[model samples]
Target: MRYDDDPWQVAIWTSTDGTAWELVPDLDSFGRAGLRDIASSDEGLMVAIGYEVLPPEEGSQDPFTQAGKIWRSENGIDWIAVEGIAGQFGDVAYRQGEWVVVGAIDGRAVIHTSADLVNWSTAMLDGLESALGESKAPCPLTGRQRRNGRSLAGWPISAPPSSAPQLAWRSASGAGMHWVGQVDWAE
Candidate 1:
C-alpha cells in the first residue's frame, strides 16, 4: 500500500502469525500507484487492486485521470502487475471459481468478472441507480468473501437516510448479485 504523503513507493508485507510481520523488498517498481485491497483464493492465488493516476496535460486546468491497476501473486512474495479493465478498481473477491472486482467508471458502478484473472468481462450495474438514485454515484466499493464462500460488495451512501447503508450480495453458488438491500446492523 502507498501512503498519501509517499506516492512513489508501494510496500508489500507478509505475516504468518497475526502478531509478526515482514516487509517484502524491491517493490519500488510499482511507482505512483496505490493498492486499495487484496484477496487470496483457496487455491493460494492472490490479487491486489488499485489505480494509477495520469497527470493532466501541461498548463491545463483539467483534473488528472486514473486507470485501474491489478497485481497477482501465487506466494504473496513476488508480485506481477497485470493489465486491468477500464474502471478504477477498489476491491476484489474470489469464490466459487470466479474472481469479482468492484469499481466505478463515469460515475456508475461496474463489476468485472474473470475465471482466470487474465481475461475479464465488464458489466455496468444498472441496479445501483435504483438504490442510489440517478444523481449520486456509489462510493468506492468494498468486497468480502464470507467463511461460507458467499461474496458481498457494498458502498456506504451518505444521502438523506444515512443510517441505512446499502449492500449487494451473491451466493456461494456464483449467482448474480442481488443489489438492493439494507444492512441490518442489529444482526
Candidate 2:
C-alpha cells in the first residue's frame, strides 16, 4: 500500500494468515517515489515498479519531475532498488519465466522485459502511435494474466476532439504481442 503524503511512501506487508499483518521497513532508502504495481513469480521473486520523483527545478511551474524505479526481492523482506532503466513505469507482470514492465518513455509507449530482473531489454510500441493518433500522449499501460497462459496489456486511447477514451488491448504469451483491438467504452 502507498502513503498519502508527498515524497510518496510505499510499504509492503506480509501475513501468514489473513487476520494478522506485518510491515516491511527500511524501504525509505529507495528514495522519493510512488509504486505503481507489484508482481511475484512462482519461484518466490517479487518485483515492484514505479517512478522516482526528482527535485523540482528552480522557477519551474511543474514540480513533478519523475524517473522510472524498480525494486526486486527474493524473500519478500529484503528488497534492492534497481537503477538505469528509463521511463515512467505503470505496471509489471510475471509470465512464462519473464518479468514484463509496461510504461511510457518520452511520451511513447514502451515495453521492458527481463528474465533475471538484472538484465533488461526494451521495445517501443510504434504501432501505438498510429493507433492513438499524432497529438495524443502515451496512455498508462496495465497488464493482466489469463488462465490460458496468455497475458494482456491494455490502455485507453482518446478518439479525437476530446472524445471518450477507448480501451485497446494486446495479447502475449511470451515475448511477442499482437493487437486484440479496441473497445469503445462510451457506449
Candidate 3:
C-alpha cells in the first residue's frame, strides 16, 4: 500500500506473505507530497497521483487547495515527475491500454484519460447522479475487473449522512451499479 508519512512524504510498503512488510527506501522526492492513489500500467510503469496543499499565506482566506501532480516509476523505486497536468485529482488506473483518472474540478466530477500517461483529455460527468442526487465523484476510485472484456469501476460514497462510509460499485460490462456493505462505528 502507498501513503504519506508523518512528514508528508510518499511511502510504499510491500508484503508478499501478508504478514511481514519491507519498507522501500528513497522513494520520497517532494517533502510536502501526499499520495491519494496509485496505479500500475500494463507496460510496468507505476503512477502515483495526489495534490500538494500549500500553506495558507498571510491574510489569505484559504490556501489549502493546490494543484495536483503525477509521479511515474518504472520499478516502483525511482520515480519521475510528469509535468503539465495539475488539479485536485484523486485516483488513477491503467485500463484498456489507457490511463484514466477521476476527480472533481470546481465541485464537479471529471474524468481524464491518457494513452501515454503524458497527454490527456478530460470529460465531465454532468448527469451521472444516484437516486439520492449524489453525483459528485470526489472520492478515490479503484477496482479493476475484466469480465467479458469490459472494465469494472467502483468508488466510495462521498459525504455520507452518517459517520460511517459506504461504497458504490459498477461494471462497464453492463451489470449496473450496486452498493456494497457498510459498517457501524458503535458496534
lDDT per model, in order? 0.71, 0.69, 0.62
Segments of candidate 3 deviating more than 4 angstroms: 1-6, 61-63, 128-148, 154-187
Candidate scoring better on lDDT of 2 and 3 = 2
Candidate 1 lDDT, 134-174, residue by residue in tens: 65543355555463344667676555566766766655676
Q: Is candidate 1 or candidate 2 better by lDDT?
A: 1
lDDT tens per residue, model 3, 12-31: 88788999999889875644
Query: Can you give the TM-score per candidate against the true fold?
Result: 0.77, 0.75, 0.67
Number of the top-ranking candidate, with lDDT as the measure: 1
Best to worst by lDDT, what's the order?
1, 2, 3
* Stretches of candidate 2 exceeding 4 Å from the true structure: 1-7, 16-20, 133-139, 158-175, 182-187
The per-residue C-alpha lDDT of model 2 at residue 185 equals 33
- Model 2 lDDT per residue over 1-187, tens place: 2232464667777779988998887777556777778899988888888877776666666656667889888876566887657788878888768888888888778778888877888877777767766655433555554535446666756535575433333345454755555434332
Residue 60 error, candidate 2, Å: 1.5
